[model samples]
Target chain A: MVTEIFFKEFHTPNNGIFLRIKDSLIKTRSKFQEIWVVETEGFGKMLLLDGKVMLTEEDEHIYHEMITHPGLSLLPEGMRVLVIGGGDGGTVREVLKHNPASVTLVEIDELVIEVSKKFFPSLAGSFNDPRVKIIIGDGVKFVKEAKDSGFDAIVIDSTDPEGPALALFSMEFYRAAKKILTQNSFIVTQSESPFYNKQFIVELLKNLKSEFRYVKNYIASVPTYPAIWSFTYASDSLELDVPPKRKISPTKYYHPNMGLDTTKEIVDEVFGCS
Target chain B: MVTEIFFKEFHTPNNGIFLRIKDSLIKTRSKFQEIWVVETEGFGKMLLLDGKVMLTEEDEHIYHEMITHPGLSLLPEGMRVLVIGGGDGGTVREVLKHNPASVTLVEIDELVIEVSKKFFPSLAGSFNDPRVKIIIGDGVKFVKEAKDSGFDAIVIDSTDPEGPALALFSMEFYRAAKKILTQNSFIVTQSESPFYNKQFIVELLKNLKSEFRYVKNYIASVPTYPAIWSFTYASDSLELDVPPKRKISPTKYYHPNMGLDTTKEIVDEVFGCS
Candidate 1:
C-alpha cells in the first residue's frame, strides 16, 4: 500500500491549501504555539505555526519585502524600527536592507527563532548584525512599557489574529504602539486576506482609522496564504503617496514601480462606501 | 457516521487547493472534457472542467473583469471584439460593458453554454444581447477562416493549456488571431498562474512577443485559481501605458487605478532577464 502524507491549512472552515510533504523536518510544541518544519518538493522548506503556514522558502521574499518596504520607504535613513512577533527574522532581514539605525524585534517564542536559525539561516542571519536587537518577551507588554517617542516605525509581523497574537490586532495595541513612535512615524501590519477574512480586515481597518490620521490598505499576492494577502499602513504625518526616499537594491518583489499604493476601491467595496 | 466531500485541484504534483462541497450540482463528460459543478460552502456554486476549477460564483468577478477591462478599456467605443472559447459568457458580459459595436464568441463546447445559461444566468445573459454573436465551433479554425482586419480586440478565455484548449496557447493560433484583428487592435488571454505556471507564462509571452510589435503581462488575484493569475496583452500600435480610453464602471476589481500595467520585474525574474 502507498502511504500519503499531506499538510493542510483551512482559511475558512471550507476552503484552504494543501501540500504534499516529502518528510517532516521537525515537529514540536513551542512555548507559545505548535511549530512544524516540513520539506516539500515544490516549495522547499516550509514553516508552520499551529498548522498555519508562516513562510516557505520559495515565496518568503514577496511577503517579507512587501511587509517592510512600503512603510520603511517613506521614512528617512537610519530610522529606528520595531518588529513585533517576527521570530523567524524575515522581517528583520528586509528591514536591514533599508540601512536602519536599529531594528528591535520582540518575539514571545524563543523556539521559533532557534528553529529558523537552524533551518532558514539566510533569514535568521539578520540577527547577527549589531544593529538588530532581539527581545524574547510579550510584544504587547513591551510596547506598553517602552519609552515614548523613541522608534521611527513599528511593524507588527505577528501570526493571524488568534492565540497570543490576538492582542496585536486590537485598537488598544495600535494606540500603545503609537505612543512610542516619533512624529511622522508609521505602523504597518499584516491585515489578512481580503477574500477569506473580510470581516477581520474591515474591523481592523476601522480600528486603524480610529487611531491614525491616515490609514491605508495595500495588498500583495502570497500564494501560500489564503488568498491575496493585505497590509494596513497607518501614519500621522508622512506623505503616503510619494516615491521612496531611496532605492534599496537586491529585491525580487518590492521594486519602485510595484503597485504598493492603498487600493481605495477595494477599501470602499469592503466598507460598503458608495 | 458523517461523510465529507471535497473538490480538490492540484496546481503541481505536490500542491493545490481544496474546498468542502455541500453537494455535486452536476457531473457530466462533454465531447471535449469532463465537467463538474459543485456547491461549495465558501465559494458558492463552482464549475470544474477536467477536475480543474474554472470559476466560482463568489470571486468570478475578479477574473472576468481583469481579463476584459485592461485591454478593452484601451479601445475606442463601438469597436468590434472577438472572444475565443469563453462559453460561459462571463467574458462577453464584461465586453458588453465596454459598449462594443458587436462581439463574436467562438466556443468549442455547446454544453458549457447550455450549463451556464441554466446555472450562471447573470453571466450567460449576455448571449441574449442583440450585439453579441455566439458561435459553436473550434476557435482556432474560426480565427483562421475569419476575414482579415475584422476585430478591434480579441479575448482568449480558454481553459488551461491542455486537452482541447492546448491549441489556444500556441503561436500558430496566436498568429491566426492576429490576422483577424484590425490595425491598432489588441489581444488578451488568461496566461495561467505566475507562481505555478511560470514556464507556461514565459513561453506564452515569448510567443506573443514574436507575433506582436509589443507584448505585456499583467496579473490579478483569483482566489479559486492556483495562485495569482496572469494575463497577456499583445498589440501592434496601441499605446499600452496610458489611462484607459474611458471609464468602465460598476467593477469590483478593475478600475483605472488598479495595477494592470505589465510588471516588468516579474517578467524579468521569470525570463531571467537582466
Candidate 2:
C-alpha cells in the first residue's frame, strides 16, 4: 500500500523547514494566533502556533527541560515561579518536577490554553495540579501589577520577539519582572537562533546585562528547532553554578550534567574572556 | 510595492528545509550525484550534492575546522596526513594551518573537485599549496591497499553512510585505516545527526571502538545541517586533550578555547560518566 502524505510547513523568517503529517487533528485561528495540532510520522504530534512550530511530541523535552530546569535549579526548593506565555503547558509540566511552592502561568490567549487542553493532554494535564494558577492576561501588564519580591524564578516561554511578544523582550518588561522577583532570583527566556538571529541575541544580552548583575547566554541543539537555539539567563544576586538536589525523571533529552556543561561551554563561546 | 520571491528547496529523507535563493548559479549531474551552487539571501552561497546540502559559505568553517584541527593538534610538526573523500578541499585548507609535511587528499570523483574549484574558490584554492597531493580514485580501495604505519592522521570526509560512502563506515574500512596509521595517529569522520541517524552513529561508534583504544564522539551545531551533527575521533595511542601550539588565523568560528570546550562538552553528553 503506497499512500502519499502531505507535509505541514513551518516558515522561518529567512528559511523554512517542514514535517510530514498524517493528518491535521486541529486547526483554528484564535484571537491571538493560529493554532494547529497535527500527527507527524517520525516527530510524533506537533503543535504549531501562528504557523510556527512550538513543540513536537518527540523532542519537546529538549526545549522545555532546558528552559525550565537550568534557571530553577539555581534556587532553593519550594520556590514560587512565574511563566509568561507558555499556554501549551509544557513549561508547567517541567516546573512540577521541581516541586515548586506555586506556579503561576500567565498566558494572554484563552483559546491557546483551551485548545492545548483538548489536543495536548500529556502537556496540558499539569494544569490540573493544585499548585498551578492559570491566568489569561497579557504577561507584560500582569508583571507590572504583580506584587513585588514574590517569585524566586521567572521562565519566559513566549513565542519569537515579534508582534505581541515584542514588548516581552524590551528592557521595560525585564525591569517590571525584576520588581516582582525576590532577591537572588533568576529569569530564563528563549533569546533566538545564533545563525538567523544574531543581532537580536546581542541586543537582548546587552539589555539583560544592564538590568542584572550576571547575565549569561546558553545554547541547545534542538532537532525540531532545526538550528542552534540561544537561551538567556539573568540573575541579580544568585550564582547559577549550583546543581539541583531534585531529580527530573522520565526525560528523554536532558541530564543535569549535560545542562550545566551546555551552559558553561556556550557562555564561553558567546561571552568568553578572549 | 509588495514583491514575491521563490524559494529553493532541499529535501531530506523524511522532511525538508528551504532557503531563499537569488539564483541557481550552476546545476549539473556529476558521475556520483547531482551538484548545485545557489546564491542564498541569509546564508550566503550554498552547495548541494545529491539534493542534500553539503555546506554553506556561512557555517562550513564550523564543521571543517572542528574535524581537522582537534585531531591534527595532537601530532608534532611536519607530519604526514591522509584525507579520504574530501572533494571540496575545505578539510585540506584547515589541515594546512598546522604546517603539516604533506597531505594526500584521495577523492573518488574528479567532477566534484572540478566543480568545487570553479565555484568555491575560497575552499578549493588550498589545493594549489605545495603540500597537497590530490588523487581521484576509490577511498575504500585506497585505505585497504595503503602502506602500514606511515601517516600521522587520516581524515574520512565522505558523505553520509550511504551509497558509495557506505564502505567508509564499515568495520572493514576502520580495520584497514587502523593498519596504516602511526602509533599516535588519529582518524576523524563525520557521523550523521543524533536525532535522525542515531542507529548509524551507534553502530559506527561500536565498530570504531573494536579497532581503537580511544574512540570519542563530538557534536557541533551547524546551521545549514539543521541537526546536531556528530563527528567521531578515534586513535590507537593518543589522548585528544593536547592543545595545538600553531595558531589558526583568519578563522571566523574556531578558537583553541572554543574548540576544546566544544569537544569536552559534547564528549561528555555523548559518552558521559553519568
Candidate 3:
C-alpha cells in the first residue's frame, strides 16, 4: 500500500477528488466488490465500495436526509419502507426517525453491513431496531417479489449503476417498485452527478416518466461527491405539492422550504425530461 | 516541473478536489501571485492564480453568466457599470452582451491582463471593445472616489477576500459604492463558496446590510469550485422582483426563472445571517 500525506483518489479515471487520510484501517474484497473503511482527516470515517466513496460520516447526513426526507415527507404516516443498496444503514437511520411501522433494508452485500457494524457502529446501529429487517440478497430479486400492497415509500440508495447495483436503475426495477408501492406511495433513487452523468440521468428520467404519472428530480450538493448529487422522485398518486405530513428529527440539512427550493432548481434543469 | 497525466490539486490545506490535466503548460510568478494556465482533459484550459483554480473554459460561462446576469437583469437599460478585479475579462464579456453604455474595469494587476490576452484571447478579447475602460489601480481606492452620479451596476468579481481584494468586502467600501450609484443602481459581488466560506460570507452580508436597504443572496453550482459559489445583490431603491428589462443572449446557465430559483435557495441557507 502506498502511504503519503495525501491519500489515493479513488474516483473514476475521467474526473475525481482527493481526501486526506489519517490512517488506513480496513481493506478487503467482498463477493460483490472491494470494500474499505478509512479514517479521513477532513471528512471523518469514509466507506469505499469498489474504490468509490459511498459515505463519509461528516457529510452522510446531507445524502441521507436528502434521499429519504423528500420522499417520506410526501407520504402518509406510519408505514413500511424499503431501502435498496444502503448497506451502511444511514438511509435506514433516517427512515426510522419517521416512526415507520416497519423498515426493510434489502442490501445485496452482507459484507457492507459487517464493515459498517465494525467501523461505523452508530450508522449500522439502526439495524438493531425492533422494527427493522435486514435482508442479504439481490435487491432486484427482492423487489420483484415484494407484495403488491404494503410499502409507503421505497428509497433506492444504490451506488452508481455498475456492478451489483446495475439492475436497480433498470426499467424492470422501476416496474417492480411501482407494483409494490401502495396508493400515494413514492420512490426516490440516487441519480449520479449531474455534471458527469447527464446522459444517464436524462435516460433515467425518460424511463421513469413512462412508468409513473408524476416525476420530479431533486438535487443536493454533497461535498464528498464529485459535484451535485441528484435524486429522482416518481409517484402515480401523491401530490408532491402537498406539505409533508410529519417532521423527522435529528436532521441537519433537510427542511421543507429548502427542499422545495431545491425541487424547483432540479425541475427546471430537467424540465424537458418529463 | 512535474509533468504527468494527472494534475496537482490547488485546493486548500484542509480539503480540495482534483482536475485531470493533459499537460503542465505555463507557470510564472507575477507581482501579485503565481499564475498558471494549464490544459485539462475534463475542464479544458484552466487559469490558476496563487495555486487555486480561478476559471476553466468548460464552466467559466456558469460563473461569468451567474455573476453578471442576475444583477443586470434587475437593472433598467444600457448604463454605466464598474467591475473590480476581473482581469481575465470574462465578466467584462458578459457585461458587454447587455450593451451597457460603458464598462470601467478596475484591476490591480496589469500582468493578469497581459496573461489573459496571451492565453485566453476569447475571454480577454472584450478589452478591445470601445465601451470598455481598463483601469489598472486599487479597486477599494477607485470605488471610494468614483463620480457621484453615473454607474447603474457595480460587479465586484474579485478573488477571495484574503489578499489585495480584502478591502472590497468591507463596510467602508460598500458605503463608498453606495455613494456613487444612481437610485435604481445595484451592486453584486462574488461571495465565495457557501460550504467553505460561510463565516466570511456571513460577515460580508452583515457589512452590506448596514449600507443597503435591500440585500439578497444568490448562488450557482460551479462544478469546479469546492461546492456552491455565491453572489450578493444589494440595492437601495430597486425592487428585485421587477422583471428584466431586456434579454441577454448566448447564456448557457442564467435565466430569469433559474435565477429566481437559485436566489430562493441561497437566501434560505443564509437566513440566520441577519
Candidate 4:
C-alpha cells in the first residue's frame, strides 16, 4: 500500500489546516527560512516559508489584490512603489496594474525569487517589467539607507511577524519607512489574521498609529491563510475611509465600493476599544 | 503517556480543518445524525453533527448575525418570522433582536435542541422568549403545509445540502418557501463558502432566482468555517440591493452600510457571469 503525504501548518500548537499532497515538487533550505513547493489536491501548488504557508495558487489573488489595491487605488497614476519581502512577486504583479512609474522589490531571500521564477512564472513575470527593479537585500536596511521621500507607496508583503520579517513590524522600521515615502504616500502591511493574531494586530496598529496621522485596518478572506487575513493602511495625509480614486480592472475580489469603512468598527470591536 | 484527541472536518476529501480537543464534553448518536460537543483549544466549545462542524463558540456570532440580520433588519419591526432547521436557537436569538411579533422554529431533530439547551445555553436562551414557538418537525413539511403568505420572513438555517438537509436546498423547497412568505417578505439561507462550494452556490443562486424576482448574495468572514461564508437573500417585492432598513445592535459583524452590493459583483466574478 502506498502512504499518503500531507502538509500540515499549525496556526497554534493545537489547531491547524492540513492539505493532501499529491507530490513534493521542491524542498530546500534558504538562508533565512526553509522553503518548500508542494503540489496539493485542493489548492494546486503552494509555497511555504519556514513550513508556514506564504501563498497558494488557488487563493493568492485575494491576498495580493487586497494588499496592493486599497492603498494604490487611492493614489494618482504613475506613482513609485516599493514592495518588501514579497519574493514570490505577487504584490509587484498587482502594483504593475496601477500604472506605477517604478517598482522596487526588496526580498532578503534570493532562493524564494529563484523558486518563484521556476515554479510560479505567472507571479514572477512581473519582475521582467521595465518599470520594476529587484533588490536582493534586507528591506529594513534598504529603508534605513534609501533616499528620503522617494517612493509614493510602500507595500510590506512580508511573512508573519517572525524570522527575517520580524523587524518589518517594528516601530523603528516604520519610522525609517516613513523617511523614504513621499508626502501623501501610504504604507500597507499584511497585519496577520484578525481572529488568530488579535494581540499582534493590536500592537501593530498601536505602533502604526503613533507614526502616522491616519491609520486604518482592512480585511480580506484568504482561505489558505488563517481565514480572516488583515492589512493595515497608514498614512499622514491620505484619508483612509474614502472610495477608490480609480477603478481597478481584471479584479476577482476587490471592488471600488467594497466597504473600507466597515473595517474600522470591526477593528474596534475585535480589540475591545468600543 | 496520554494520547491526544482532535476533531477534523474536511471541506473536501483533500483539505480540512482540525482543532485539538481540550475535553470531550458530550458524544452521542442521534436518530438523524451523530452529535458531539467538544471543548476545543482554539475555538472554545464546538458543536458537531455527523463529524462536521456545525458551529463554534468563538465565531458563531459571525454566521448567525450574517444569516439573520441582513434579512430581518430590512423588514419592519414586530414582523412575523419563521426559522427552518435552526435547532441551536442561534438564528432565533438574532431574530428576536429585531422585535419580531412571533417566531416559529421548525427543526427536524429534537436532540439538537436538547443538546443546545444543555451545552450552548447562550444560543438556546432564545427558546425561553415568549414570542418563540418551537415545532419539533421537518422544515420541508412545515413549509409545504403552512398557510399561504403567513410569515413576513423565512430564515433557512439548515446544514449543507447533504443527508437530512439535502431537500432544503432543492428548487421545490424554494418554491414552497416563497408561497409561505407574505408580499414584500424576504427569505435568506446560508449558501456555504464561495471558495469551496462554488458549484453549490451557483446552483442555489439559480434556483433562488427562478423563485424570486430579486436575489442577492452577501458574505461574512467566519474563521471557524471555511474562511468566507456566503448567504443569499431572495424576495419578490422588496429590493435586495438596498441598505438595511433599521439598525441591528449588539452585532459583532453586520453594519447597515456594509456594502451589500459588493457581493453581487463577487458572485458574478466567482460564477463567471460577468
- In order, the candidates keep a fraction of the true contacts of 0.44, 0.42, 0.30, 0.55
Model 2 Cα lDDT, one tens digit per residue, B26-53: 9999778898888877777788888778
* A219-274: candidate 2 lDDT, tens digit per residue: 67777784778778899887554345555655555555443323223344456543
What is the alpha-carbon lDDT for the whole of candidate 1?
0.85
The Cα error of candidate 3 at residue B142, in Å, is 1.3
Which segments of model 2 are wrong by more than 4 Å?
A1-14, A238-248, A255-273, B1-13, B73-79, B238-250, B254-273
Q: What TM-score would chain B of candidate 2 score versus the native chain B?
A: 0.90
- Which one wins by TM-score: 1 or 3? 1
Report lDDT (Cα) of residue B71, candidate 4: 81
TM-score of 3: 0.88
Report lDDT (Cα) of residue B195, candidate 2: 68
Residue B66 C-alpha lDDT in model 3: 80
lDDT of 1 at B154: 93
- In CAPRI terms, model 4 is classed as medium
Local lDDT at A64 for model 4: 94
Clashing pairs in 2: none
lDDT of each: 0.85, 0.79, 0.80, 0.86
User: Deviation in angstroms for A158 in model 3?
Assistant: 0.4
Tens-digit per-residue lDDT, A1-274, candidate 1:
3226788898877888998888899999976789999997788899998888999998898899989987898988899999998889999999999899999999999999999999999899899999999999999999999999989999999898888889999878998999999998999998888776777887887888788888777778888998888888999887555346767767776655555544345667555552
lDDT of 4 by residue, A193-229 (tens): 8777777888887888899998878778888888678
Q: What value does the interface RMSD of model 3 take? A: 4.8
List the candidate numbers ranked by TM-score, top first: 1, 4, 3, 2
